[model samples]
Target chain A: MTDYIVPVLLFAACAVALRKKENAYDLMLLGAKDGLKLLVSLIPTLILLLTAVTMLRASGAMEMLSRFFAPAFSVLGIPPETAILVLVRPISGSAALALGADLMAQYGVDSLVGQTAAVMLGSTETTFYTISVYFGAAGIKKTRYTLPAALIADITGFVVASLTVRLFL
Target chain B: MVMSWIFTGLLALSLFASLVLGNGSALAAAVPQGARDGVNLVLSIAGSICLWSGVGKLMEVVGFTGFLSKLLSPLLHRLFPSTRQDKDLGQSLSANVCANFLGLGNAATPMGIQAAQRLAKRSEGIASDELCRLIVLNTASIQLLPANVAAVRVSLGCQTPFDILPAVWITSLCSASLGLCAAWLLGKVWRR
Candidate 1:
């Protein structure tokens, strides 16, 4: 089902273009060129943000912070060991994946922490990364309430992920 | 402005923590490594981004986007009233949401950027309420399939990788709903 999505969309697009007598190839090229420009603009933002996140992880600061927050997180029903996954999920996808994989390896994939980590990774987005890319491409600097609201969503995701794993799994 | 402060704080805290923990050398190495990783990530998704953007253009030219926006307009208009006034923005937002629904992150980003660009047009540098809602929607991640998580679970020898589908669905819907509500409340309170 997932595999057919792109092809189906493209087929529909082409069929429409053919019916409408539009020059689909030229329009596609024009759009691709615009995409390239957007990609170039996003490079600096991605590099800088990724570097900061990576540095935070590599310096063990993320682990330290996770440890600091573990007790509070546990009160919310999130396992203390999965605290790093919760913290990193909103900041960076790759880092969260790494942490999730590590948790699964350490605790076994069937364990409560492992399943919770998987569910959390599945459900949450890297808020900082997504915000930076979208806003940076448009050159918008003041995000206003986006970050706080997104964080609220993320915290909800983390909590719900744990609860669902406990109830269903 | 706030983003800059967060970025600075992250760097400052990382450097401070590394120095205190005697991990400065590792931190120094991670900077370059991270830049490389970022470039690699971009390279990986570049083709898909361009492809989707091209497809998006084709869709727009062929009026497929119009059809999509019309199909989704009822819900979209309620979430983003600006879409009712701006047809193009509606198309872009619909495309972004569709891509996200399919779990096509690479495709979603470019379409999302297009929508963000449209939403940013009226606001003078600061993000508008609609733009904030768009970000919240994307950050909440309402995707049909958790392919990445399933892949990791499969590699780690989980017998039923997709068993968590229901949980994923529940969490995603809840988070997106909560995020949108928060954005709406915040927008109402912080109206300037």
Candidate 2:
């Protein structure tokens, strides 16, 4: 079902273009070029972020911090084991993916903890990364209430993810 | 300013922790490994991003994005009142949300940035309420497919990866709704 979505969307777009007698091929090339430019501009930020997060993970700081936060998080129905995932998720996407993969591996993927971790990963975004990139591009110096609100949302996602998995999965 | 602090703090804290935990060597190795991984990640997504961007351009030319904007206008009009007066911004926001819903992170970012730029025009170097709300919307993760999570589950030997869809949906809806409400409430309070 999910696999069909992409192809279906593409087909619809192409059909529309043809009906409108638009030069679809040339426009696609132009957009692709713009995409390449966008990726090039994003490279530095992505590399720096990934490096810092990887260092933190490799040095075991994430594990240590997760251990400290485990009790608090457990009160919210999040298991102690997935504490690192919840922590890393808001800051880094790849790091969170790695942590989620590790959780599913350590516990069987069918286990409650693993299922909860997956749901959490699926439901939440990398808050810090999104905030920084979007605001930075807009040259907004004062983020005002964005960070607090985003963090609140993230916490809501994490807590609800655990509960949903527990009740449904 | 905040981003700078976060980047520096992440590096400083990691270095301090590595020295104390006797994992300095691992930390050293991870830096280059991570840089390589970042490049690889970009390369891996490049094809899809280009493809989607191309398709998105076609959609734009054919006015499909306008149709999408209208389709979602009732909710969007409230969330982004500026969209009612600014057609371009509305199209960009709709495109971004559509890409995000399909879990196309690469395609979403450019469109999101475009929308953000337009929103920023009304502010004086500070994020307006609408701009902040847009950021919140993006950060709340409203993806419907969650393909990446399902793939990871499949690799981990889960027979039915999509079984968690209901849980994902519930969590996403809850988070996005709560996040938007929090942003709106905070905006109201801060204005006082």
Candidate 3:
């Protein structure tokens, strides 16, 4: 069912474009051009955020952070491995993906740890990155309360994913 | 922005810590590698954003966005009250949510940015409460497919990659709801 979404949307879009007598090719190119512009503006922000995040991860800061958070997370039924993914998930999707994949590979995907990682990955977004790029692009200087709100949401996702694994898996 | 400062601090601290902790080589490798990853990240989503944004334009041309806006207006109004008068904002927000629902966040991202820009048009340089809520919604987007995670599972030879759908749904919905509530409450409090 999930696999069919793209194909279904593609067909719908083409059909609608044809029905409306809009030049599908031109419209797509126009959008692609806009996307290019948007992506270009985002590059600087992405580079800075990614550089910091990647450096943090590669420098083993996450390991220290994970160790610090491990005891608290364990109280909530989360393992140390999953704790790293949860912490990184809000900062960078690629990092979270790599950690999630590592978790699945290290512990079978069906295991509780792997399952928790998968659910959390699916449920949350890269909050800080999203705030930066989106707000940065829109030229909004003050982002009051948005960070804390999004982080609250991320924590909920992590807690819920852990509980979901415990109850459902 | 504060985020810039935070990232700068984090990078400097990490580099300093790595140098002191004997992991300088990893940090050294990460600098160039991070730039490459940033480009790769953009490239990875460029095609998806292009395709989705195209589909979005077509949806507008074909009046599908109107239909969608009407269908989702009740809920959209509750979340974004200003959308009641602004069809364009409603349409873009609806498209963003639609893409998110399909687990196409990379696709939804351009739409989310579009919506944020639209919302910002009515305000000064500072973002409005509604715009902040929209950003919060996008960050806590509720995914229906969880396709990427499932794909990773499949690659790892999991028998049922999509088995976590219920978990994803429950967690995402809860978080999104709670996040929205927090945004709304905080927006009201901070405004006064």
The prediction achieving the highest lDDT against the true structure is 2
Best DockQ goes to which candidate?
2
TM-score of each: 0.67, 0.72, 0.69
True contact recovery of candidate 3: 0.70
CAPRI-style grade of the A/B interface in model 2: medium
Ranking by TM-score: 2, 3, 1
Q: Top model by TM-score, which number? A: 2
DockQ of 2: 0.52
Candidate 1 residue lDDT tens string, B1-192: 655776797788799889889988899999998787556545555666676667767765665444655677799889999988898888789988866766656667888899999889898789999999999999999876666676567667787777887888999999999999999999989865
Rank order (by DockQ, best first): 2, 3, 1
DockQ list for all candidates: 0.46, 0.52, 0.46
**Candidate 3 lDDT, A3-59, residue by residue in tens:** 465568778877878877888878777766866776687667666666666777778
Tens digit of lDDT per residue, candidate 2, span A24-141?
8898898778778866865676677767767878888767777888889888988877886787799877567656765676678999989998999999999998998999999999
Q: Poorest 10 consecutive residues of model 3 chain A by lDDT?
A: A1-10
Winner on lDDT between 1 and 3 is: 1
Put down candidate 1 lDDT per residue, A31-105, tens digits, no spaces.
888778867866776677768767877888867877888889878999888876676677766656656765775
